[model samples]
Target: MKEYASILSKDGLKIATFSNHFRSEKGVMIITHGMGEHSMRYKEMADFYTNEGYTVISFDIRGHGLSEGKRGHTPGYEFLMDDIERVYAQVRADYPSLPIFLFGHSMGGNLVLNFLLRKPNNIRGAIVTGAYLKLGFEPPKWKIILAKLSSSIWPTLSQPTELELDALSRNKEVIRKYENDELVHDRITSAFFVNVHFAGQYAIDHANEIKSPLLVMHGMEDRLTSPTGSQDFASNSGDNVHLKMWNGLYHELHNEPEKQEIFNYEIEWMNKLLN
Candidate 1:
């Protein structure tokens, strides 16, 4: 069953969140959707966890999906962090005795990883998929320099990230749904891009600060976010981090044919952690 709720962010943005309950509950998982998508996109993934006796919770971030805010805009990185913190607090309060885990993808993964670095809380662990540590392709040097220069003057100025949708998934239905999804857009504010770019690199540099056991997964063939970044982070993130590289898989591993295998791996990982 999917239930919805709304909460006010520190900066007064009303964020939208959802909870999907399983018939039998073992624990709760909080999912974070990637850029240009909403909480609903994770229905299948959440349901998979639900069937495994886990309740799932996820939110549309301040500027995305059904959430209230300017599309693709943010006040600052600090503002975004506070919004995530508010969601974490609410979920933690609701499930006081249940173990909590986090799952974030792409841009959401970047924020979730940084959230740990900012403050390593009492959460059990995390799973990051196709995290945006470094872009598989970078924006032009001049454009990035200019965006940084003008960001303060015009915080909401839109810039296209030039993400290749074709590189997202091998499944036709998944790609089509994403392309036709009205909520999906490639334009993000100059300020948002600058903040995201800096934060992605910062998360890697401070990987050791991550206090939770982490499972980091990326596709070796991922042309969106550089897989090497994930590899490098896993290599140096001490013994607590486990890295998985899916050969020839696209950015959306959940949509791939081998998704069940990955899901089984997640089930095993989380179950062991819970035990």
Candidate 2:
């Protein structure tokens, strides 16, 4: 079953959500999407999980998709965490008795890791892909200085992300679709950019504090976010955390040609954890 709804955020913003339910679900997967994208983008992955007897829940973060907030802008990092907490609480209340796992990609991956470290939760495990721990390339020194300066005064000032579209996936069709999608944006605010950049490092520095099992995956050839970040994170994290580097794939592993194999691996890992 597929359902759509909206939930009010803590400060009274409407957050759009989507869910795919299975009759006898074995578990629940809560997905958080990356910057400039919405929850609906994960339809294929959600369907795969539902077929595997798991219900899936995903929400557009406050600033993206059908949710309310300035596009690509948020007041601060705490608001982002509160949005995740709201969705998580709803899932826990609705599904009271199923194993819950969190999955995040790109910026969403960064947020999930930070959330796990800073917030108290009972999730069974988390899966992170292409987390923006470090950018594949550094920004111009002047641009960095400008962003820092503006972040304090006009934090919500939006700027184009200027990402290379081709770096997202090896599948040409995926890039084509992403390029054409109206909901897919390229805006990022100074505050959003600076805060997440630092938050990524914070998650890495405190990786050892994470108590739940973590599966950190990144594409070795990813030009969007550095795989070394994933490498460093898994190494610093506890033994329960594991890392997988996909060779030749770009940033979006779930959208790559070998996505099925990747999905199977994730399901297998989750099953092992559940057992």
For TM-score, the strongest prediction is 2
| Alpha-carbon TM-score of each model against the true structure | 0.96, 0.97
What is the Cα-based lDDT of residue 42 in candidate 1?
85
Off by over 4 Å in 2: 140-142
| Cα lDDT tens digits for candidate 1, 91-160 | 8888888888999899889989998889647889899999988888877899779988878889899876
Give the Å shift of residue 18 in candidate 2. Answer: 0.5
**RMSD, model 1, all Cα superposed?**
1.4
Prediction 1 TM-score vs. true: 0.96
lDDT of 2 by residue, 1-275 (tens): 26888889888899998888554458899999998988888889888998888989999998898899899998889999989998999999999998899999999999999999888899999999999998888678897788889999999899999889999999999889998898888999999998898899999999999999999999999998999999999888899898999989999999999999999999999999988
